[model samples]
Target: MEVRTPWQALTRPLAYPRSVWPWRSAGYLASSVVTGLPALVVLAVLVLFSVLLVGLPLLLLAGVALGGVERRRLRIAEVAPAADPHRVPDVPGLGAWLRVRAREQATWRELAYAVLHATVLWPLDLLAIAVCLGLPAALLSAPVRLALDRQETKVVKAYLVTSYPQAFAAALLGAVLLLALLYPLAALAGARAALTRALLAPRETELRDRIGEVTRSRARLVDAFEAERRRIERDLHDGAQQRLVALTMTLGLARLDAPPGSPLGDQLAKAHDEAGQVLTELRELIHGIHPQVLADFGLGAALADAADRSAVPVDTDLDLPRLPTAIESAAYFAGCEALANIGKHSGATKARLTARYDPGPARLTLLVQDDGRGGADPDRGSGLTGLADRIAVLDGTLTISSPSGGPTLIRVEIPCPPPSA
Candidate 1:
């Protein structure tokens, strides 16, 4: 069987020689010796020429080249392919590429691996191949050597073989040694592949890429949510709200036409009153889903409308340019929620809504404060938790400060550019 990695070959002791694993392990280690020598020469030259500043770029180039070579070599002993952690430069220029590479941790890690392979790892590879494969082959030739010399021969320079029987016995010992050494050979090769992966793999780069993807995905979800909200609002306005208005109109006309003091007249009046009430409730529900004022006139006007509708009298001092739809929606809803909470829970009879847009930082700040019995806890179903999550999607912040005595304040800040006229 063809095992991809040394570890897999190590597990099947009976099949070690019948398969290509032994030769592969030998080739992998032998190749390291060849690759390691050039690395040592290049690194040594780079260090010696450091005073000329000519070697720095060459050193980086060598490290990068060696990193590629190491990853390819890992295939001889690893089933899984090593991942490349280097990022492509955003701009296509040497200077841009260098700057990007210099900032990456992967570049330095590869350099360290190159240095270690040259100084330490290659010699180990050579020694492992020699001890595991070479000594056994020498012993297997002991009988032939004894016959040719017509005298005793030393096997591996350790065992003496004078007669044919003793020479054959030495050859048998060599065969047994070769079989025993196969497992250690596989183990050493596996360790070398693992070390190569650890040094050359781009694990940190992959993590950063994944985090960026998650952030962008979250932004997309928030955008899709807002689009759905707008669609619902449009359907209600153009379909259900218009139908209810027409129904109310029809009932009003019927009530006027009905004869006075009659049962039919009283029934028409009741139906008309019920339709008008239902229409009013539907309008409120539609506004709650997504306010039309906020979409048409922007956040400042929407805040003023919300304050006017509050049970507690609210004063407004908002000055903002039109902003991005997502920013405006989050800020408006946060304000509305704070106001609703104040009216229901806070005993404060008066509230103030203030908003301002700062051009310098491209930020919008909204504050809602009330003189009410305070001590509000978001964790206790205060509804501010959802608002905080919404603000976070825009890379914004929501803060609440409510003392036990009175004066609760809710502040929201969102980073977004002011809308163009």
Candidate 2:
């Protein structure tokens, strides 16, 4: 598997030594000095003048800014990007932004993390890198040191190397030690990344709120889409359909006025027939776009209308009241698609549709079954997948169970409040 972090890289023991992760880890730890030094200075100044009210706000600003920088630095040890835990201000301008940031728990948590990093964490990070990498590097340079000094050299400032052989031996030992120490170095980097993520990433509750917002936005889009469909349906029904009706009537009258059995009369007759056919198709298109019955009378009447128009016989057991327009529309279209699929592919001679609303749970349930040679697969380019996606936007679910020999069943469950609610 591809490695994304130091821990994953460490899992491949043989590859770890040759890999760049050791150097990456060292860089990640050593770079702490860059951030830590500034943080320590700023924090010290804040503490010195903390008795003044100005220090408190400055400290908050410093912590919030440092948190953003540290989250970016975390990428050196971690491949996956960290999500900012803080929410955007509802309004623009600096005052609004500061008020929102100051009110969030994440801001305080980040401030705590900043304090810890400045006082303790960064120092420990530098110390680990020094012990693991700096010492080995010093030892490895013993041969060069001996050559320069010509008499003696200090090995890691601890042992004396008086001869070239001794220096070479120290270097070999340093090489082995460096390789061995890198495992722990990489492990430490991974731990640091995890801690940074834990402190800076969005909490579970925040994540849930984000997901809920996205769901709500998607639902609004779906509502807008349904509204557009209704608008188009209305335009076609009121504007185009009426105009086509007038054209068809005019052609009929012209056919009657033309010479009997003449060529012009025959052509007029053909044109009139064609106009009537076009009008019929346009009406069907309008109904398919957004059925007037579904909007005016609710899903029950719409389902009955759909069943009446189905190619195969369909029996419906509907116990539905007027539902929210979105739910009713979604359920109606889903049922229509199911019956259409049954007629097109299922080879079903008979089908059944059942729908009801449960007031206790505030849920709506719809089931469509067919006594056909059942091998329906929505993944095989069926319209059901898109319908299912639409239903899911409403926090509803659509499931299908079609075994190979016979009998296909599709169940749809949607949690919705009663229309009164």
Candidate 3:
């Protein structure tokens, strides 16, 4: 793949490779270096002559534009480094625009970018243009001169050199050296631009800020997950588990006193049956909160159980090794949600679920497909949103494709598996 870096895109293209004219190349490089400088000088000159131009109004409007430019510059700086893009704000009216410009740090940064855009980019452009074109022109000059003049095998000039052999050697050497410099100079200019943006802008601070935000988000997700789990555990243990245990004891006692098929025995059996039903529902509820199977049997088993519970006939195709609880939980839960969505809304008869681990990509991907009237819109439900959050915790991705027809597919890719332990 050909990768053109942000700095190279902005700077080098202006001068180099535009035309092969040697003097023009030199002039381009010179112009590139001076581009940002001239902008800065103009801004400064304008500041001094603001009153003369249109008093305070022109300076104020210029300042607003300068602010927008500064914001744009910062956004560029951040993105140019593969960092977060702090986009420029759209300020609607003149008053809003003025306010945005006046109130933003980004504005100043953008103005500085414009100024540096001229100062730094111009010279590099000039240099690149000069080196790329001038040496070739100098080398090729003797040949063209030979053809145009066609005077002799040897020609006399005010300088000491005259032989065709000497001219050929000189021209060839110059061309080789010129071409040799191209890559290194291009690389250096690119590096210099990166360094320049880092130094001139607040990219370092912005990176730190983005890192901190990501950390906080992760922490919040962890805390929230734990809190939800604890709440569910409390409900199951105190409310349902306790009730089921009592019912079991009661049934054991009733079984001892009563004989089979008697009226009293039948009544006790009915209560006993009710207890089991409640127990099953409670288990389902607890699993819904956070599947204990995910902890015990890993991702594959949990999804299998989900498929079993699903009302629709599910064809499960899954093969996976034991994975960490977190990864298994995310995968299992994501699958569960997708399948649950399919069961609830999909009117088709056949549904299929598959989970496979790709060790090479280091991803655990799951697919839930249904031959149903597929019209699942994420906008209408929180199930997909919560699934998104779960996968995001693992830095994974989720995608659903459900046209309003007979087939629907839900695909989830967890890029990095959780800690193996």
lDDT of each: 0.89, 0.90, 0.65
- When summed lDDT is taken over every stretch of 10 residues in candidate 1, the lowest stretch is 201-210
Model 1: residues with Cα > 4 Å off, grouped in runs: 1-45, 52-107, 118-186, 200-220, 293-328, 347-365, 392-396, 413-421
Runs in model 3 deviating more than 4 A are: 1-201, 216-220, 223-243, 251-274, 417-421
**Which lDDT tens digits does candidate 3 get at residues 282-346?**
87677677766676677788889989988888999999888755567778878878877777888
In terms of lDDT, model 3 sits at: 0.65
lDDT of 2 at 81: 77
Higher-scoring candidate on lDDT, 1 or 3: 1
Q: Candidate 1 at residue 293, lDDT?
A: 93
Worst 10 residues of 2 by lDDT: 200-209
Clashes of 1: 1
Model 2 global lDDT (CA atoms, 0 to 1)? 0.90
For residues 161-185, could you state the per-residue lDDT of candidate 1 as single tens digits? Answer: 8999988887898899998898899
| TM-score, predicted candidate 2 vs. hidden true structure | 0.61
TM-score of each: 0.65, 0.61, 0.46
